[model samples]
Target: MRNLDRRLIQVVPSRRQLEHQQLEFYSFVHFTVNTFTGKEWGDGSESPSIFNPVKFDAQQWVDAVKSAEMRGLILTCKHHDGFCLWPSKYTKHTVAYSPYKNGKGDIVKEVSDACRKAGIKFGVYLSPWDRNNPAYGSGKPYDDYFVNQLTELLTNYGEIFSVWFDGACGEGINGKKQVYDWERYYEVVRKLQPNACISVCGPDIRWCGNEAGYTRKSEWSVVPARTRETELIADKSQKEDNESFRQREISASDQDLGSREILRDETDLIWYPAEVNTSIRPGWFYHEEEDDKVRPLEELINIYLNSVGGNATFLLNIPPTKDGLFHENDVKRLKELGDFIRHAFAKNLLNDAELAVSSFMRGYGIDNVREDNYLKYFRTDDGITEAVIDITWENEQLIRYIVMKENINCSQRVESFRIEANLGEEYKTVYDGTVIGYKRIAPLTPLVTDKIRIRILDSRVAPTLSFIGVY
Candidate 1:
């Protein structure tokens, strides 16, 4: 147990992925043809005459999103119905054909402009399944068409922060499945917005195997990396079959790809994180009947704690009404949630705690540490699997939230950890978990203590922590 020279396997995220993890929480704008048709999956036959947003206001959308403290918004520029919000030369089913603004107003342009004006990030969701295109099932011809449309969006929109995709594939006009050219799509995003992340159906970010806005207690961002060839074939594969190995589930078994253990023989480890998506309403599209069903402020707070707090980003859907504006109830709920979150985490209780580590690497001592500094480290040894940080508070304080972060530059190493409060001479365990990637926010029952301890029970290698905060 004394081999001190051992090095843990390294798993680091790309620059774009790092930026995405920092966002933590954002909103998804599912406004499109489906909003008017009252259908989650709209057929390609929807006429342009019905697509109108008389009182459309992009600034209002930004106001709602900003009020929620969400980092940005992701607009559904197009859905499965093959309708486009922006005028694209590749198709006639766009805003150009719609009577709104005499076909001159571009939803994408307005939203992007509003996001820039509001100082928030902007993203786009372009569904790959086109039920209207006749060339969809025609192999190369359909791929060419899809790429051209993608190019138009990437080039026209001002600096998109994320390009999202959905794996909703279906038979086309020719009664054959249209093959998606995912690699080509990635290439286009990289060329146009190199800093943007391709989310969910793409590589940089992945779906959490469920759309219920919840993540597992032990969600790890490091997973096996797949080549371009494997990615192309993965979309069409059945999830219940061998494809299950490639997919990451919220409550996946310990042996799953994103589980705690390393699956070296199966796939090379890479930093592919999870994204939890759920709508604010009962449905993704705004419905008149569901107006009163806007999720309560408490529920959204819980989701934010679980998703954004569980080392994964939360993508909450807040659909716009057919009149092109967020519902009044939804806006109020968002503001309430944002206010609660900001107030709850306004100050860190452990900011001035006398922090001490059981063992640390040289040149990584903790003194006058800031919020995001990575100078603190507990270098791992072959015989050592545990490290402890004892914090002596200036005064006994009641705290309900504990935040932990790993120096992901060295990869996600902590597999299991625990937090305890010292009561007299005895210590009581308050919280424990399996992984801490970029950030892990654990909300516990309020506890009053003058001393606290963090113990790393298990790790792939010696672990390194960037920050530990209590609020």
Candidate 2:
């Protein structure tokens, strides 16, 4: 085990940067031994032969992710109990030994292929602790074994978007240290997926220090001005002053603390973007007994606002069952959730309003503005919409184009809309009649003007809009 040169940790298109672009949306696929026994795998002890999934439909999972507008998916290739989803040459205790379909299928491949087809990025969750493998807690030899398993995962999988490592270190066999070479792990990932973002214990980001998702309204005060590597280490003596410590490297926090409750007040100490991960059910795995415990759409929406809308990325865990398939209840709820999001912000002046830009407006394009700053104009009940935008320049210049984003809420109706420039002296009509939600109306391009204003006309009801950009 070797320590990496702290100076070599250069930031590329890291997780922080990707998050800034794709704002607050990711999927968590919790699939492992927990799905087979209807019990949580605290220590990886489940038999790999039980990994059979007869009617697994990877496409359905991908479809759910795309419909939900999620940018990435993190699969539980190996849980704490150490059961591997894909067959590994390093160990026989994997899907290769599973009883389902006589251990002949690879759940990881199915997911990766489906994600590629759906145009969604893929990531994997590999737990460092393994209660199932006797060698896991057996000291140095175990560390070597662990590295081999990781190498198998990295080399076998195609381009991974991320590799999530949880710091749930368990006791080694006979009280020996479970010492790990984190630098080696980081190097392996860099070699396999050059652009992937490592999570929690890697170079790019660190855990949120706690797994609670809820944060106070003023939590932004806790976020560090910039990420620093020094903050990644957990010092028992500095626990009280963790908030005061600042670092120069970017970091991220994860929250899956409770079943449905997010401790919103704890967000005050977050230094970087927080991630909220919760399962669709009470447990992270699919349980026949918990089949009726599907989370209601309203609860999901509340979680979305309190987490994703609260300036954090939301990681909703949708676990597949022993049959290697998402429960019907899970599927229906995902679709319902997607529809709810689509209808919440559907209609706006940006969608149908005419665009007029002043000839003097110059040096401004959609790509030039910061995403969070750009999203400030549009408002939604849950804060997910970004439908309307206003721009003012120091000098008049020619404007290129105005783009009205598609509505996330697709069920709502828009009655009418109006766009007026120069305080209503000159105006152009955008939408004059009924319009369904989720569909993009039209774009107003090459509008040459300086000052512009917009108003929703005769619209009593409107869906929540995601975004509106002016350049």
Candidate 3:
């Protein structure tokens, strides 16, 4: 038990963190002066006169997001270029000076209103590095200006789900680098929107180490508290995932982040889950030349199965064109992605499963996992870290996928597990995995079997499963 810190095993996600994890799939709306300039990072010299998306329709953006089964949209309120989507009284470089709506339209307000009206969550991405303001590298003054803009987004928007920030620091207009007030900015988000989860540079969510739709074969949610540091991850692969994709001091992306061996030295632990993000096109912003370069349907599906299914929420960026709408090519791909999700999850083969467990803890039994609702789950007695779950069907059935979810509310504990199917005469391992946090989606090689066995090889505490499903 030397590596098993009860304190670490006992760590749980806060209400807001738990709610954010369940979002599973969401959209990152990256629209700004960059879209028009065909630049990924805009220099602070663009004119607001050329920023109009005359045909811009926030509703269309929401519709595209909703159709793709995404539950929320995080719009880029401002980028490193220092242009504000909403008219901020603190800066003259905002949508207020744009020709759209005759210099009176607020893109932030329009998007937030559309999200609320569509019954989906709204979030904001406010870059910490502002390159336009003259006081950019002046320390406290820039932080103050940043906080003022942050406060405006949180208060003006009805209910913000996420306050996304990136660690993209560079020399500003004055040719000096900024020392960001990370703690101060976190406080403003906490005070204004207590329910919102501060993502990336903040505490609630961690970047999944890349923006290439890449995911770890086994993504773990519970990590040592210090792992969220930008300095440590920056020097290594784990450190370079955020801030406009900063180059890593090291080149490898696969790193052992959370394991019993890794956690033994840590006194503090946290449920800082990962958010996997990538763009639909080659770049974060729309460029007509890259129109045909939209990610293929199969690539998108693989990203979903690996990210959303691998203990991290998937954030796919679907940028708007210069005309203020999703490109037709991107829209077409979104529909395909939506249809694939609906058809794949329409029916749960587990409905026909007769579940039985080797042991149970008092009232917690097999029935808890029968319905993947996250309310109740199957748990074993203390010291029973290893157990077996038997699932059977009266008639032979072909199982294509097996999905498992841990009631992380109870704290993530299962360390390793494998699924076996009775194909002919004996049970054979079909899929194996580690760390099932909020959810884990595993696909089988397509087998016909009447029985499936789940072997929980190890866990931090008595293993618990909120839900086990077959699809």
Candidate 4:
């Protein structure tokens, strides 16, 4: 594949959004007041004195994350309990009132500094619901308080890559729900960190519709355009009278775009990618009882494949223990997962193989080209639907994974595909899958073969391939 240039067919991603998608894999640090309370959702009545971590080390946390091959870290600066990690002037119920460093510790500042020093990106997750704030249910006062805290984080921190918001709103201390001013919150993020992509309850990125670590089998990065109103309305209203509307929005947001032959709402097409977020353990916060329950190495790899390999960003939550460090078991598991991935994908078997396509267009015979800029096409006399590309290897080699990529700049075309390996002069089917969007890494059983062929079974148009590889 070489010397091919074409206009993008699908909705284009913003520079920030594209960079975010390229991150592929990252960890979410869910350390908060709940870390000490042993609760998933805290009611904000707990004493700040219980939040002391004597051996806290932000550098150690970042080092562990880097060792795991993750690109960045998203610190849960605040949760539904409204306990701020930083010493915000807005609330006395923060670390300022805690015993850590005699009320002089700032978790956000330390983590951000550690990230910058370690050369990985940093992000912030501030929950919209504040159960501790007395002014929460009072519209204008609560909005002002929330915005002021947001401004403190964005302005104080160096550069935040992503800003995360959850749909978890509950009744405040007054037993009345607080109406979050999401628009104003988004406005502040844009003004402070324009390069950051807002995930969930914001306009930039959409949730994968579940907390599980995998997306739909046929996940599509492109979906129907979302309006401002739809973007601001969190899913918390599902149990209220707006249940139908919430359900519809959720359905549309996570709609599987790979199964469609023709997107009828072409005019409304938008690049709203999904983010697969899941905890490293069954719970988001660290608990001593669940120390041995860290997600096994195999499960971590599977989660990576399903999320990052399935064309979606992955946010694996790795909660810090009460000691302000990753559990020894968690650190060991992350290292093992990273090592397995690095070794498994160390080299591509098809990088230098002799390549030929069934239907070559403009004398562009695929010579094992794997770069995204140089796309190889299979355009025939009668509008090519199905085409095969044969690769001749030097000798038999072990093949475990096959990575495929469509020229997504030209749109997601291939609907289904199959790969066959020539085993002793007899070709045998090894793998079959759907939707090769930006990238699709198909893991398969190790097979020894000297030659292999890939057949595109279905496509909306003559597909343009940017890469095809075996590892």
Candidate 5:
């Protein structure tokens, strides 16, 4: 494969760019083997007949997504286990053979139609590794089969916002390389859904180069910077590039690893604006045992703040059951999360005097606070060591407590810290703790005086501390 020349590429508004501009969010409908067999779909083999969503309501799903403030939905058209959500003309192992609706309904079509009706974007995830297809192992033929299936998806579905092709390759039945004609696939997509963003290995966006939900302090926007340097680079490279070489704008996607244990090293390789994909349940798929595993509203808010607020988009997965139904618990949690997010951030902090950030002490870091300028201060022998910020009000405004925030770029341990108001002569020690790695901090407190200052005392490692803001 030839490297994409940054020059000849016209900066197009990718799906991600559109989403960002629209303040739109996404949903990952992870329904497949995991929903049917109550097991994760990694082995790539499952009975299509087992695929049934009796209560499947594409409109309802779309309505829920819209209600949740999401702009796009990505259905798991075909998972790694190779079960097709639609009745594929290329394979018998699909919803066409399923007992759901007597195998007469096409889930992808319903979803696409529903999304269009709701004026939202539609996308699909087609796993490259087909475990059940007998020809999957036959290298040359498998490529053809894959293309055929791709054609079916692209041609059959409505205008797709994205064609999610994950890099999950495995040995076919004949034990040959799972070779894929990506160029052919791209061509098909271009012909069908010309406006769609081909994800991961495609021309537009990459996989953060990592799937971790966490985002770096400095996130790259999907809208490529139209600089003279980029243009010159692209021109030089594209001149020598071949026809097979596709030139696409840069983009990124990300998902949180659903482990309870927090990642120690918070440096996620995924680029921003990364999409944080987390499930409402313990697993990505639905299971009887996981019916009660819905994530709490507060926890979901934290995820949103850290993910989307941290300069990454949030892709919250809510899997449907085998019966093609969302669990009541899941629905409740989703509603609660939506309500909490609106109530917390949507409300003007200037009006509500209830919101405040108490401690700006060491160890605590601010994750995502909006800023108009980059505040650089206190450069160390190595680099910048610490930063202090203060916000004051002139009149008695009906404002809530002030917020002190700092963006941590690298892993560091804090020794001590203090927060002081301009009112007092001496600084008062508000919070003192240890912040381990790269993370944003948001400290809330009761409304107090407007003037506030934060100071960091010590650190084990040094990372770029972006800025402090009062929100």
Candidate 6:
């Protein structure tokens, strides 16, 4: 259409990105030395003896994650403090020197094996900034050390789904920040874990601009290519010497990242989707004071909708307690969340409704919307961005929620749309939305209606919608 840059609708996600998006919700296990110190960031001087989780149960962690209806778990194998959960021969400041299992336990292996047995995907997060290593801040030596640690995790883990990184660079043991060999780190991941998607500071996924559980009203997957580089650089610049782990997230929260106006002059375009990460508690690490402070059910649900249901996937961080187990309070809220979701979408109210579309591509049909085929979507003819789909049933059906999905494999073209319900004589807008990338779970007030219609108000090109649901 126009070198794939001028035409935003033609840009699509890579295979790795596509598969990653399919995992709508996942868990982020943020357990490290920080869990013991009651601090968010450790200074890398903590003793290995303080690292033991005597009652640690990896299965308990995975079980709690599964109960929440999450698809995967990304463990903080090592944090910025340079405390490796796995026993690395390269560093004495690891679980190897810890008191757990008499200095022989490997938390990484335990969690990975538990995940494999539980039939859930496992991923790793190895911080690039190793404050405990003397080689850091030294040229090639630090790069070699980073590669060595990364290779160990990839080679040992059964099937790594993602490798999460952040741009938290601080003074190393030598008092100078080490220049990360970003390309080489990505290459190591590619060579060992061919199917894994590198996230945040890597290629496949982007951080959703904030860790406060906030999401853009219209999240776009096809942003300018420079976003990947500019964001990492920004993280380093916004860092404070006292708070080595925090970054200013709201500053990057732009309202229109991939609008037609923004992409018209861009030289490059990429399918860099955002991953909305937020901790269940106020902080990423467990503190006894925050045990009663687990996120409320309603707050978690809103984040789930705005993230996994928005254009981005949700990475909810559930930090483990000092005992290395998910707190009972956290588990209770997770159960409530899972039960609410399963019971909410238990049935699609539009199942038996008659379907009719105003227009469709030559080979497609209106019936495709009712089918479970994700690829077989109902798309409007060329240049016909505005369209409609009407549904009716013999008796009034109660619908509390509406779901819409764009066939983003063809690129996210649907910009604005509304779902209307005919409560009595005329139709009324129940929900209005924008940017239905991947998935959009729109909630509505409980209403009884036998007839409903979807109106596509605008789009950059002919709109393609893969799914619609009434719940």
- RMSD in Å for all candidates: 3.8, 13.0, 2.4, 4.7, 12.0, 2.1
Clashing pairs in 6: none
Per-residue error (Å), model 3, residue 441: 0.2
Model 1, poorest ten-residue lDDT window? Answer: 1-10
Per-residue lDDT of model 4, residues 83-184, tens digit only: 999999999989999999999999999999999999999999998888899987889899999999999999999999999987666789998877777878
Model 1 superposed RMSD (Cα) = 3.8
Sequence-dependent TM-score of model 6: 0.96
Stretches of candidate 1 off by over 4 Å are: 1-8, 226-255, 259-264, 373-384
Model 2 lDDT tens row, 82-153? 778888777777888877657777888888988878788888888776666677656677777777877877
In the range 1-471, model 6's lDDT, one tens digit per residue, is 333322787689988899999989999999998899998878788898898787899999998888889989999999888999998878899999988899889999999999999998999998888888999899799899989999999998789999998887888777988888898999999999989999989888988776778888888999889888934544644243333233235455476788777887897888899999888988888889998889899999999988988989999999998888899999888889888889988887667889998989987777777654566888887778789999889998888888888887788888799989997799999999988889999989999998999899987668877778888
Q: Residue 54's C-alpha lDDT in candidate 3?
A: 79
Full-model lDDT for every candidate: 0.80, 0.55, 0.86, 0.78, 0.56, 0.86
Native-to-model Cα distance after best TM-score fit, residue 221 in candidate 3, in Å: 1.7
Off by over 4 Å in 5: 1-24, 42-45, 208-212, 221-272, 349-471
Task: Quickly count the clashes in candidate 3.
Answer: 2
| Model 3: per-residue Cα lDDT over 1-471, one tens digit each | 723746666888899999999899999999989989988888789988889897899999999999999999999999988999999999999999999898889999999999999999999999877879888999999999999999999998899999998777777999987888888989999999999999887799998777788788667778888978765543433221243453222124345678788777788788889998889987888889989999999999999998888899999999898999999889999999999989877777778879888888998998798777777888888777888999988988877878888888878888899899997789999988887878888878989989999998888768888887787
Better of 2 and 4 by TM-score: 4
Instruction: Return the lDDT, model 1, position 144.
Output: 90
Model 2 residue 103 lDDT? 74
User: Against the hidden reference, what TM-scores do the models get?
Assistant: 0.91, 0.64, 0.95, 0.89, 0.65, 0.96
Which residue pairs clash within candidate 3? 233-239, 234-239
* Shift of residue 427 alpha carbon in model 1, Å: 1.3
Clashes of each: 2, 43, 2, 0, 20, 0
The lDDT of model 1 is: 0.80
